[model samples]
Structures are given as structure tokens and as C-alpha cells.
Target chain A: MEALVRPKLQEAYEAVKRALECVHFCILIANCEVKYWGRASSKLGRGQRVIMLKQDGSVLVHRPYGYEPVNWQPPGSRLSAELKDGKLVVRAVRLRPWEELVVEVYEVHLLAHCKLRDDARFEMYGSEGDIRDLLANNPELIEKGLKRVEVERKVEGGSIDILFIDERGRLVVVEVKRGTAGAEAVIQLKKYVERLKGELGRDVRGILVAEDLARGVRGLLVREGLEFKKIDLRKLFEVSKEQGASLTHWLTRC
Target chain B: MEALVRPKLQEAYEAVKRALECVHFCILIANCEVKYWGRASSKLGRGQRVIMLKQDGSVLVHRPYGYEPVNWQPPGSRLSAELKDGKLVVRAVRLRPWEELVVEVYEVHLLAHCKLRDDARFEMYGSEGDIRDLLANNPELIEKGLKRVEVERKVEGGSIDILFIDERGRLVVVEVKRGTAGAEAVIQLKKYVERLKGELGRDVRGILVAEDLARGVRGLLVREGLEFKKIDLRKLFEVSKEQGASLTHWLTRC
Candidate 1:
């Protein structure tokens, strides 16, 4: 990791381009405001936040309050920075799925490049198939009266991670992700819901069940009329073990 | 960040999906090998390395020996995991770019999620532009005979950061990046060189000058027929001070 402290305007300007071009992930901690143009013009008030630019050209404007970024540009976006009129104007744009971000630099306290590595080792014992099989056998993992009808349910576009029958006997397609769910996973879940709705000849609800969700994904899920559920696999496994269920059997079956 | 110990197979499976769905960056440190299928199939022998899945769906397999990952999948790739015959098979694929990665996990030691944040503040006194300007004014920074012709030269795609004439009187387009330069930076430099090639009516050499270059990017620069030059801004600033040159003056002039 390399740290840059209180660089000049031109230095900061060049840093943005260099960071974007070099694929060196950067976190710009600054007290500034953001302005957006292109599809719809908007502005954000000055606040202390972190602006993370991944090597793949993704940009995230994150405030200190939440885990989600206030604004972002997806991967593969082209980033440009200029020191114009004493302000560092940083812009990121993508062509195919059109998106744009413009950040006006008012004050930059610190900028650092991170060489991310998985430093510590962790032993992950359980498997996704284990969760699926557990849910398939035990509906209680979801809620009382809701039962899982099938595991790895196949659909038109792809396979649904889990298919369930709610308390009211409504078909539910559950998309599972390990850590925090992002916009991509939600979009995928929406597709599954739409596909299942047509195939089942009825309305289907989508539930994105993950250990956690990115700051903004919950809003997206609600807007898309889907549900978000946080499930802890480690705890779930402990509970299953207390019930004396055969995990090895479930693993084999899955 | 969450840590699990010797989790059941099902727990592990669910963890992978949850991690991928949720945007929590994951580091899978395992004693295993990898097999990639897309964009030219290849396999890596068994070794101890870290497989990092970023919040943006990018995957990097890094070994301890080098700064760059042995294999990587760019952001926006779709990752899927399955437990087949007791082996964890992880796959990541991208459509538009046509890339795929498959990792067969024979054994797993640890899996962890990192909540990345800048814990400390750093003050970068001088700037990359200062180094560029100093190098521009003082050819000795690069070599004795290299002289900068233009600070920011206009080109078709965009402006080349710097244009210099090498010792051999050959045109050299310089792209300066902070910290470590990656493949993306090299690719951008390549584009600049290609554009300059037609306009200059001669072979325009390219030099990616940065604080450091990532392990993989060096090879890329060589393969692309470009040059890699390391320029330490801190050292250059110190040298400028010794020369009695006012950095503030040079900065304002640049």
C-alpha cells in the first residue's frame, strides 16, 4: 500500500487517472460534495466520506453513516480527472450500461492505494448444498408454516437456489448469496421471479437470503417488490446439530 | 467481518453464496489448485495462495511470491460454487468479455471477509505532477539526454500526460500513474501509443512511469512493446530541494 498526503491539485488530478489506469485500488478520504450529470443531474451536500475506486474502474462514493455508497459507477467505466479552476473534477463513465459519476474535490485529507490480500485463514465447514438440503428437509429454517418444496430448482434462465412454499402456499424463489448481496444479485433474483411468475401462471415473490446485504441492495429489493432476509449459516448449522440431524447425510443427498 | 470454525459442509456452501451475494469482500486461503476454462484454458499446480473475491464480483488468485495474482477475473463476473463428490468447485464467468475461471477446491484452511477502511491518515507533501515537471525540466531524472518537449500534448483519444524525446532522439509518450501500475494502465498506454503511431508517422515508444509496477503489469508492458520506469516522487522532491528549486514555484508553473 502507498500513502499520499495532502498532494497538490495537479498531483491529485494525476492520482485519479493513475489510480484508475493502474488498477491500484484507492480510498480517497475527503471532506467534499458530489455533483452528478448525464442521465439526471443532482448534487450531494458536503460531508466526510470515503470514495473507493476499484482497479476495474468501479467507483463508490460512500458516506460514513452506512455500508452502502451514496453514489457509484459500475466496473469497466472510464475515469478522468482534471484540476480545473482549483477544483479536482473526477469523472467516471461507462458505455454499454450507461452510468456516470462526477466528484468535485473540495478537500482531500488522505489518499491511499491498497494491495489487498487475504492475510488470515478461516475454516469454512458447511456448504451451500448443506443449507439447501437443510431447508428442503426443515422448513423451520425460514419460518413456521413455510416449507421448502425443492432444492436447486431449475427454471428457464437458470436454476433457482431454493424454491419454497410460503405460509399462504405461495411459490417463493429464494436466491442465496454468502456475504452481502449487491445490485447484481438482486437483479438476478428479479429475473428469476419474473421467469417463475410466467411459468407458474401466478405471481411469485423473490427473497434474497444472504448473510448480509450491501447498504443499497435492500432499497433495490423493496423497489423491485422482493424481500430481503439475513441468514447466518454458522448459527443455522448449530441449531440443526442440536436437533440431531445428520449433516453428512444431507451433504451426500445434496 | 465474520469468522467460522470447522463449519459443516452445508454451512460452507451457504457461506460461499452468501459472501458472493452480499458484497462483503472474501479471501479464501486454501491449499489447492485452480483450473480456468475461458479466454484460453490453463491450470495451476497445487500451491498455498489466497483467492480474493471482491465486493464487485472480481476474483484474484494471488501467491505469496509476487505482488500480482496468478489468475484473476475482472469485476462484473458471475461466480458460482458447487460441492461435487466432496470437492468444492468454484467458477466465475463474464459474458461480454468472454472470460471464465474454475477453481477445484480439494482442501480449505480458511475463509474470511474484510471490512476495508483507512485506519490512519497520510500526508503526501509533493505530487506526481511535481515529479513530472522536475523530470520534464531536469532530464537527469530519467536519463541525461531525454528531454521533455510538451507537458500535456493533445492526441486523438485524449491528451498524453507527457511527451519526451529519448536519448536516441526517438519520440516517447509517457503515462504517469501513482503507486503500482496494473494491466489496465498498460492497456491505456498501449492505446495512446497506437494513436501516436499514426500521427507521428514513426514508431512512438511508450513508457509507463509509476512509483511501482504490479508483477503482472511488467510482463504486459514488455509484451506490448512499452517500457516501465519507476519514479519515486519523494526522492525526486528531495533532489529538487537540494538543487535549490522551489517546489511550490515549479508546482504553480506546471
Candidate 2:
């Protein structure tokens, strides 16, 4: 790892170029103007931002505020940096889509680079898939007399999250969302119901199952003749924990 | 600025704690396990991740592969670092939403911190507002005989981007998107057209203007009886540049 504090423009440029060549993750705190041309063209005027060039060829330019990067290039980009006209210019380009991001640095406050090793897989709970699995196992969580027919039933265009039969024997098509269910979720559920109604020639009901509904989505769901069910993720997580604990206890006893 | 390479766990923890107290942006490259509980709960196993703690109290954990932070806390979070049980633990908490993110570091490869000064505003072109402005000024870009009625017409729920009168003398409601128009965009345009139809008691045509269309959005637009117009952003940018050049020339002569 190499760290240079308040480095000269030329010195920072040399270090950045060397880091890129060595396939190291580099961080540069600089005042820079950024220009990006790819799917869309945008130019950000000069500002102090943190520029991160990852070993896997991902580039992120983050402003002082906000979680999202002001400018970014995904993984598998080609990166190069040089000193041009007394300033440092770093460019990242992708071949297939031909996207390019250019950062012209006027001053460098700090520059650091190091090789990172990360191989552990990410384990996430309370995702959309987890919610779907819980609902599949416990259909009563959705409704009292609902019975799960199939989970992830494939249709023509996409797959239905869960297909259930209500007490009235009507087919219910479910769409699961981990976050807020928006107008798009309602449209998706409506589409699934329409497709199932045509294929099965039966009365199909669409239900959008999510943690919460976005503003104005309830009216949209009502207009589409679909239903919205709020799932408490905390409760779901507790139930899942209990199930896991019981399973572990049974295994130990066996 | 301070940089420590392959320092002792205790030494790194003390430096991180001091940086937090001094209101500095701190970076720690370490093998860590992260747990976040907030809008949702997620756990990332022990891996080498880049942890950025900004002076504004924002925290980001990057896993080296993607542009997005695997775990993040927005600005205004309360941050603290400590050493416990032969490991370093960093915590960030938000009060309003009652969210917390904890990163337990097993090994620190690199640790750096610096006070960053940034107060520059971000200026960008070819955003949604930019597209709307261009379409409002030059309705011919959308269609030959289209005339703009209003740029942002306020409705009950939200504001329409652009409202135009087509050659057929029908009301056209335009929803401008900087990126690809997805199913949600189509649904939004449909809602706008419906609202305008009710208010005007006239035939309203819904047109979704975007740089591209997401998969299956074209079919959704068709089913919703809406129109899709692909705007070439590069051409729009060229026209904008020419306008700017002419405007600058006019100013200089004046």
C-alpha cells in the first residue's frame, strides 16, 4: 500500500498511474471536473469529490453528500491516468457499450492505493426471496384459508411468486416485494392475474405482498382491482428464527 | 491526514476513534463482518471490505466488486469506534429512523483519515430537467407540429413534465425520463393522461419520452394505450451545445 498526503499534481498522477498498472484499488481526494458519455452524456463542473478506482475496474466519484455516487463505471472497465497540461486526468472506458468517464483533477489532497482481497460470500436475510419462502411455507400468514399451490410458477413472460387457492376456490396470483410496493408492483400483479385468467379460464385475483405500499399505490391497486397486503418483516424474521432454532434442536436430539 | 499501513489492531482502533472525534473522513481496509438493521436487516460475512466513514457521519462498506456500497448509512449518522474482545468495531446509528450499522473488523490492512473541505455545487447537463427544458423550447424535437402548452403543469398528485398540443389538435401529456422508460414510467404516464382526461374532459394522448425503453415496457405501453418516443440524448446534447455557443457569442457582441 502507498499513501501520499497533499501530493503534487504530477506526483499524484504518477502514483495513480502506477496503481492502475498494478491492479490496486486507489482513492484520490481531489478537486475535479467529471465528464461521462455512454448511455447518456453528462458533465459535472469542478468540485471536490472522492474518486475510487477499484481493482475490478469499477470507478466511483462520490460527492460529500448522498449515498449514491455522483459518477460511476461498473466493473470490467479499462482505467488510465496521466498528467496533462499541469493537471491529472483519469479516464475509465468500457468496450462493448463504449462508455467513458473522464475526471480532470486540479488539486490532489490525498492519494492512497492498496491491493484488497475479499472472497467471502454475502449472506442476507429478509430479502424478497426470504419473504417468498416464508409465505410459501405459511400460507396462513397471507390469509386464513389460503393454500399454496405452487411457488414461482412460470408463466409466458415471467414467473408468478406464489400461486394460492382461496377459500372461495379462486386462483390468487401473488407478487412479492421486499421494499415498498409501488405502482409498478401493482401493474406487475395485474399482468400476472390477467395472464393466469386467460390461461386457466378462471377467476384470478392479484395480490401485491410487500412490507409497505408506496404513496398513491393503494388507490392504484384499487383501480386495478388488485389487493395489497402489508407484511411485517420483523415478525417474519422472528418466525424464521424460531423455525431455525427448532430445526437445530430437533437435529441435535436426533 | 494520517495513514497507517499494517498497524496493530489496538493502534488502528485508537486512530479511528480519534479521527471520529476530530471530524475526519476515515478509511479502513479490513476483513470484517457487517450487520445492518434499519429499513431492513442484512448480514455480510467476514470479508476484506473498504469502510469509508465520512466527516458528515456517513458510512459506506464497499465489497470491491460493485459500485454500490454493500452497507451504508446516510449523512447525519452518529459514528463511534471501539476495540472489544481483541477486535475493532465501528458503529453508526441514525436517530430518526432508528437504524444501526455495525462493522466488526478482525484484521486491518490499511487505515487512513483526513479532514476534507468541499463546498462546490454540482452542475450537470442532460438530466430529466434538461430534457424537459429542451423539449419545451423546441417541441419540434418531439414532433413536427407539436406546440408546448406548459412545461410543468401542476396536477393534484404531481406535476407533468411537458404538456403539448399535437397536429391532430389533441392534448398530449409528455413524461420525460433521462434514462430508460420502465413499466413504472409507463404507468406514471398513464396516470397523468387519465388525470388530464378527467380534468379537460377531452381526449388526452400519453407519450413517454425517454432515451430507451426497458424490456417489456413497450408491450406495457401498448396495452396501456400510451405512446413511446426515444430521444437521442447525444443529438440533444449537440443542439444544446450549439445553443450555448450562439448565446455566448451574442453576449460577447453585446
Candidate 3:
């Protein structure tokens, strides 16, 4: 790892250029102006921003206020740094779509580069797919006497996330969403239900399953004659744990 | 700005603690294990990762490979650093909804802190709203003799983005998407058109307008007897530029 704090412009530029050659993850705190051109063109005036150059050729220029980067270039970009007319210019370009991001640095506050070795596998629980799998395995969690008939059943419009048989022997088309179910999710479930009803020649029940419902979603579901089921992540985790999955140990160890 | 490279765990922990007191944006490259418990539970094993603590109380744990952070806490998280049992521990917690992230550091590679000042206003030229406004003013770009009637007119399902009267004197419901028009956008436009048709007792045309269409979207639009318009962002920018907007100056300066 190498770091320079309040270094000269020439020194900082040389260090960044060297870091890019070695394929190290570089961080630059600089007062700079950024210009991006490609799908659309944008210009950001001179300001202090944190610029990150990743080993995967990704570049992120973040301002102080927001979570999203003001300007970014995705992975597989060609990164180059040069000192032209006493200003360090960092350019990232992609070839196929012809996108370019140029950062002209007038002053450098801090520059650091290091070889990062991150091979850790990230495991996340309670995603939409996880919810679908859990509900498919344990249909009773969604409703009593609900039996899972098929997972991802293909119909006319699209695939049903989970097909279930209710206690009354009626077929149910389930649509699972991770965080919040909105009007779009409701409309999607309606399309799947209508398609299935046309093919099966029977009245198919539609259920929109998600952890939470967005504003006006409940009313939309009600108007469409659909049902909403709230999914509990904690209970899903517990159910997976009882089945002796590795997630239990991972959560408990944490 | 202050930076420490290859420092001892105790010294690095003290530096982080002092930096947190001064509310500086701190960056740490370390081999650490991360655990997050909030809306969901996640566990990441010990590996080298970039940890960023922003002045806005946002924490991002970035692995070396991807654009998104493996673990992140939004703005307004309480950050604290400590050395416990010969290891550095960094924790960030949020009060609302009770979310907590713990980073147990086994080795510190680089630690840097600096006060960042960024107040530049970000300007994006091409967005869904921008496209809608441009089309509302120049409805002929959509179709010849198409006159826009209302912008965001309220209907039964939701607000129509732009309502236009076509050359044939039929009402047109235009749903504008910035990037790619998909199945959801098609459904939303259909709902608006159907609602208007039922209410006004007139034939209404539905048009899905976007920069591009996703796979199968064209076929879906044809099956529904709807229309699809490919929006040209470059042409829109040129039109906005001719109208003497600030976007022209910004792009030209870049």
C-alpha cells in the first residue's frame, strides 16, 4: 500500500499513474471537474469529490451528500491517468457503446493505492427468490391447507412464481416481491391470473406476496379482486434454520 | 488530510476513533468480516475490502469485484470504532427500524481521513421527466399533428404522463420511460388507456415511449394493439439546446 497526503501535483499524478499500471484499487480526494459523454452528456463543475478507481476498471465519482455516485463508469472500462498542463487528468472509456468520463484534477488532497484481495462470498437472506423458495417448500406459511403445485409454472403471458392449490381445491397464482409490492406488481399478478384462468378454464385466485405494500397498493389489489400476503423475513430465516441450513450458523456466529 | 499506511492495529484503531470525532470522511482498506442485521441478515467472511465512512453517516463496505457495496448503511448512521481483543471493530447503527452493521478487522492495510467540501449542483440532461416535458412542448416529435392536451392527467389507475390528441382526433395515452420500455411500462400504459376509453366513451390509443425496448416488448405491444415510439435522447438534447437551456453550456464546456 502507498499513500500520499497533501502531495505536490506532479508527485500525486505520478503515483496515480503508477497505481493504474499495477492494477491497484486507487482512491483520490481531489478538487476536480468531471465530464461524461455517451448515452447522454453531463458536466459537473469544480468541486471536492472522492474518486475511486477499482481493479476491475470501474470508476466512481461521489459527492459528499448522496449515496449514489454523481458520475460512474462501469467495470471493464479502459482507465488512464496523465498530467497535462500541470493538471492530473483521469480518463475512463468504454469501446462498444463509446462512453467516456474525464476527470481533471486541479488539486489533490489525498491519494492512496493498495492491492485488495476480496474473495469473500456474500450471502444474503430474504431476497425475493428466497421468499419464493421458502413459500414453495412450506405452502402452509402462506395460508392453511395451501399445497404447492408447481414453482415457476409457465403460462401465456409469463411464468407464475408459485402455483398453489387452496383448501377449496382452487388454483392460486402467487407473485412474490422482496421489499415492497407496488401497483406494477399488482398489475403483473393480474395478468398472470387472467392468463392462467383462460388456459385452465377455471377461476384462479391471485395473491401478491411481499414483505410490505407501497401506497395505494392495497387498494389496487382490492379493486383488482386480488389478495395480499405479508412475508416475514425472521420467520423465513427461522424456517430455513430448522431445516439445518448453513444460514443459521452464519447468523448465529455473527 | 491525514493518512496512515501499514500501521499497527492499536494505532490504526486510535486514528479511526479520532477521525470519527472530527467527522471526517474516512477510508479504510482492511481484511475484515462483516455482519449486517436490519431489514435482512447478511454475513460476509473475512477478506480485504474497502470501508468508507462518510461525513453524512453513510457506511459502504465494497468488495473488490462489483459496482454495488456488499454491505451499506444509508445516511444518518451512528459510526463508532474500537479495538477489542487485539482487533479493530467498526460498527454503524441506525435507530429507525434498528439496523446495525459490524466490521471485525483482522488486519489494517491503509487508513485515511479527510474533510471533503462538495457543494456543486448536479445537473442531468436526459431523464424521464425531461423527456416528458420535451415531448409535451413538441408533440409533433411523437407523431405529426399530435397535440398534447394534459401533462400528468389523473385517471382511475394513476396519472397519465402526457395525454395527446392524435392526427386522427383520437386520444393518446403516452407513458414515457427514460431507458428501456419493459412489460411493466406496457401494462401501466394499457391501464391508463383503458380507463380513459371507458370514462370518455371514445377510442384511445396507447403508446409506450422510451429510448429502447427490452426483449419481447415489441411483440407484447403488438399483441395488445398498442404503439411503441423510440425516443432519441440526442435529438431531444439538441432541441433543448436550441431553446437556450443551461444544458447546452454545460455540455459544450465539457
Candidate 4:
């Protein structure tokens, strides 16, 4: 039985291995044979194997270490209030009441916005071909929309450097500059959000993508009912290059 | 000099604060004193002042802690082409590749060879007002020669959802799933990339929009060449609401 399933899983594992720039760890096919399967990445090494799987209504399982949820996310504060940073803070962004503006001077800037890998290092691929090959092997992941658009898109009073919506429908309106988010972007995205909601409608969320987001600005957005996502363009481009490699593979193979 | 510039910056900041949820983050004003910015959620106690200004741009400004980078990034492998878990392991997904793929998948999807982003969360907002509103805020995105053709987008097998292309100078094909980015999306986007590249140019980019993203699938896309992003439908509605609040503020003053 071990021999039969091991071959198929091994084939899948190899397919994954052949297409990546980095490999953290790999779990054993046996471990994944049971239901609810997963393993610690640190333990993956030569000759070691572990995974979780299930068969026929069974909750069979295997985990080198027990699996339990660690970082708990409270339901994001009621979606009605303004988010200061990534957290829920202000009761709301006051759709009907403009408050008196009396505050000190500060600068916030929005930089590049792109989907980052869960494995930070996974985005460090050095070549585009490598990234493209990885995509060709995946049984899932419909791979048609894989291009990155970077343009100086200008509007009535401003210009957005990179305006994109990611694979998961998140509208990431990135405003990049020489400085960090604290310098000019945070405010810029904030303003963009205000104008967008006004012209777009009252149900759109925006991300203030930047290099280093100031804590205060993060708080302001979370409390103000906005979502904040961060990324460094250098790292993102590196990751994109790998994706390019994967695309190249598909272009050649198919 | 400080006082004079402070008010303008403050007004800009206030304008920004009110504009963020509306998607106004841009670069036109980045050269101003404020260069970049984002939103921070703050738990304020009315009179409890938060340190919102940066002294030297290097200091970690507080108020809203900068939006935290997503937690849980998988680690990296140390060996070269090592075998583990009954399978052969080689490089990491985020590093430079030894050999890469070169296929452009965007063209294929647009040509009906790949899938799109219409899953569970893609349809969550279900209102034209919401979808149109979301796209409207991104005014800077070019849509001249691009086509806004509606088609039956293939999400997960058997789940064909509504899809559209906001054709400007560059075609921005959007796949709206009901929920998030899963392993299946890798295949969906790959097809799109190939089709778009084939039909348009290698430069065509695809956007797979959903509400959530599974970690493995996201890593797979990074390893591949396709792009996918996550969006919270509830939060988007909130952004629109915040804009309403800003108008209310102006109205109250009048």
C-alpha cells in the first residue's frame, strides 16, 4: 500500500521540486495519506517523510508536530468603521460629517502594491524562466493573467504609479516614491480612497502599498475602515521574474 | 516657514485622510513635502494624543503601527538537489532558478484556453454598483483599445462565472471569483497569461480577483509566472462609506 500511493505523491512532489528556485521542506507521502495532512517545513530533509491524509470517510492524519491555530485574527472590526492601519480603530470614516481639520504636519506615501509569497524567500528568484516553468506543472492555478502593469497613470489631480487588482480581487492602488509610506504615500492612498469611494461608490477598499508604513498611518487606515497591505518593489520584481520564467516555459512547451 | 508649510501639509493630510477609502493614492503629489503614505488603524482615546509625525523619516512613527506584513512565510532549504520525504528536492521557489519557463499565459486565457477569477468570493458583493464602483476609483488605469467584453469565465471546474475585460490601451482582463485564490487558480491564470500574450502582446497582464488566498496556492503562483490577489468585499463597501462621511463633513460645515 505504501509503495502504491508513494509513487503518485512522489511524482507530484517532484513536479513541484523541479519548478522552484527554493525548497523549504517536503512531507512524506505516507503522512499526507491520512485526512487533514500537513507537517513542519523545518523537518523536511533527505530520507525524512511525513504528511496527513484520509480515505473513505476516515479522518486519518499525520503531523510531525500537532497542528493548532496560533495567530488568531478577530473578525476585522465591523467593516463600517475606518481602519487606522491594518486594525479596526475609528468608529467610521464619517460618510456624512466633515470634521474640523486641526492637526500637525506629516507626510505619507504609497509605494508599489503586489501579492507577496507566504515564504518571503520564495520571492527571491533570480531568473524569469525558473518562475515560468513552475506554473506549467501546476495542476491547478489557471495561468492566463500573469503580467504586471507599471505606468504613471494620471487623473484629475494626481497620478498612480501602479494600479492593479490581484488574483483574489483585491484592488491594490500602489503609489511609489523615493521615500517610504510615511513621507507621502499613506496620505496619497488615503486621498485616493476618498475620491475613489466618491466616484466609484461606497463599497470599495484600497491598499496603501509602500516600503515602510508608519505605525500612525497604519492605525489611521485600520481605524478609518480601509485595508492596508505592504510590499517592497525590489522583492516583488524578483518574484515576478521567476513568474516570467514560468510563463516562458508555458510559451515554449504549449 | 514651518508654520506656513505645516497648514498646507495638514490640509493635504486631511484631504488625504478623507480621500484614501476612495482610492486616490498617486504620484503627482509625491514630490511635495509628503512623498509616500498608507492607512493605520488606531485605537484613540479622544484626548490621548498619538505620535503621528516622523522626526527624521527613519523613526518608526506611531499612532497606527505600520500594517504588519502577512505573518507565516515558509522557510528555505539549505542543501542542493537533496532528497526528502520520499521525493527529490532541489531549489527554493523564491530564489534564482537554474532553468526557467518562458511561456506567456495571459493571451491564452483571453482566447478561451484558460480560466478566470469567478469563484465563491468573486461573487460575494453581487452588485453592479459595487463592482463598477470598485473599478471606477482606479481612474488612472488606461482603457482605450482594451475591450470590456463579458464572457462566461471558468473558475473551478463546473463553476463558470461572469468575467469582463476593461480594455484601455492595455487590456486588463479581470476574473472575479466569489471568494479567493486557491491552487486551482494557478491553472486559471496560466491559461489567461498564455492567451493574452498570444493575442495581445507579451506585455498583456491578467488580474485574478477574489476575497481570500490559500498560502500554498499563492506560493505556487509566485513559483509560477501568474499573478493573483485577494480582496475583502465587506471592507470595500466600507471604503465607499468613508467617502460618504467626508462629503457629510463638508456639508455640515456649509
How many residue pairs clash in each candidate at the backbone level? Answer: 35, 0, 0, 218
Interface RMSD score of each model: 24.1, 16.4, 14.0, 23.4
Number of the predicted model whose DockQ against the real structure is largest: 3
Question: Tens digits of per-residue lDDT for model 2 on A1-254?
Answer: 79887799989988998898899989888889899876447788777778999988989988765555778777888999888887899999987657789999999877888787788765555668878988887675676557789999999889999999886689999899987888888988998999999998989998898878999889989999999877766556544433432322111111
Question: What would the per-residue lDDT of candidate 4 be over residues B109-133, giving only the tens digit for each residue?
Answer: 0000001111111112244334444
Off by over 4 Å in 1: A1-254, B114-125, B128-130, B133-254
* Candidate 2: Cα lDDT at A87: 81
- CAPRI-style docking class of model 2 based on DockQ: incorrect
Order the candidate numbers by DockQ, best to worst: 3, 2, 4, 1
What TM-score number comes out for model 3? 0.60
Better of 3 and 4 by TM-score: 3
When candidate 2 is compared with the true two-chain complex, its DockQ is 0.19
Each prediction's Cα lDDT score? 0.64, 0.80, 0.80, 0.30
Best by TM-score: 3
Model 2, residue A34: distance off in Å is 1.9
Candidates 2 and 4: which is better by lDDT? Answer: 2
What does candidate 4's lDDT look like per residue over A1-254, in tens digits? 11112233334333323321132111112211111101100111111112111111101111221111111111121111122332211110111222111111011111111111121121221222222232223201212222233344565578655545444444445454332467256667767656756775644445554445775777776765655444433334323332433332111121
The deviation in Å at residue A243 for candidate 2 is: 30
* Global lDDT of model 4: 0.30
Q: RMSD to native for every prediction?
A: 26.8, 16.1, 15.3, 25.6
Please give, for residues B5-89, the per-residue lDDT of candidate 3 as tens digits.
8889998998898889999888888999999886468899989988889998888888875555677776778999888987899
Find the candidate with the highest lDDT and give its number.
3
lDDT agreement of model 1 with the native: 0.64
